[model samples]
Target: MAEQLAQLADDRALLGRTSTAERVSDILRSRISEGFFPPGTRLSEDSIGGALGVSRNTLREAFRLLTHERLLVHELNRGVFVRVLTVDDVEDIYRTRTLVECAVVRGLGEPPYALDALAGSVEEGRRGAREGDWKRVGTANIHFHRELVALAGSERTDEVMRSVFAELRLAFHVVDDWRALHEPYLARNHEILQALRAGDRDGAERLLAVYLANSQERLVEVYRRRVGEDG
Candidate 1:
């Protein structure tokens, strides 16, 4: 917790003078998505506020915004904590991913689509693998999909999936074997990128559908076992 507080202090520079609840929530959201604050960890209002040099009211409002995004939850008496996803939550997240992502690919207007960002994300994952940093690999994998969604060119879709993917990270944080969960997708993401580069949108969409299905199945299996063990 002390380490996390120190990290918050480091990020305080990002707030500068704006100091809005939205900016505070963005910092907290990024930290949460990065697995710095893992699932079910209580968010200390006083400590976080002090660390970020924000008032208690400002911090609470930031917490309230995160709660709306389903990244944090407020217990009636206990306090706010990072959310722990359920099996059904995992299922629904993948469902939403499949729907939105596949449609984005299918709806692409023509070949030679803007794919540099997507390719970069795939390379990022490969670099993480070379470094034996499976968590970084996992993050790069999410970055690949987020870039894929960005191909749609819709801010609203991007906003919605931003929340969905952040929630997805909460699920990822619980899995013990990061390599097992993330390594296989490195090639699949590259495959999707190749199909897009070749103007094979159909093939790309098919590959992505299979990729997401397999991933969801594997994660839910592990999630059930892990949640059951905890119970």
Candidate 2:
């Protein structure tokens, strides 16, 4: 997780004085969602604290916050590790996305209402594709969904989705082929973006619902296969 620490290092000034733990947790959460710390990887308080220039107490506080979010687990006689998501957990996350993301679209008061955040995320994914960086593509995909939920203009909703994406990354890390999992979605995301740009709000909502449902099914199938092979 050295790379994870470096990212936090780069953004160190964001911590400020107040709510330091929350800021630390945000960086750690981003690392998880970006797949830097994959599922079940042990997170050492000493190492992370040393790297981020934070105290062990602050780092532990961040771990505690993530633990509450279901992104980290504290094991007996062991250190904190990234959570390994269950199939049920995956399904529940998808369910949450349907209600949260699709509702954002359904609640739109006007068509062709697009945020640069969403457009920028799509651009990021395309650039990732050009570089053959499937992990980057996956991260951009999560950002796209986050931008979608942000349309509701709710800080509380964004907070909920952040944890959701971090947990989803657990399943993503186990995929046998990252490109296969992420490449197809690039164009799909573009289509969703274009729908919004073209004032096709209902179309966008329908597409997202189907896209999420199909993704859930594929994740379940892939997860079960991994379980069988491991067994």
**Top lDDT model:** 1
lDDT of each: 0.95, 0.86
TM-score, predicted candidate 2 vs. hidden true structure = 0.88
Model 2: weakest 10-residue lDDT segment is: 222-231
What lDDT tens digits, residue by residue, belong to model 1 across residues 106-191?
99988879999999999999999999999999999999999999999999999999999999999998899999999999999999
List candidate 2 segments past 4 Å from native: 1-19, 229-231
How well does model 2 score by local distance difference test?
0.86
How many pairs of residues in model 2 come into backbone collision?
0
| Structural similarity to truth (TM-score) of each candidate | 0.98, 0.88
Say which candidate scores most in TM-score. Answer: 1
Clashing pairs in 2: none
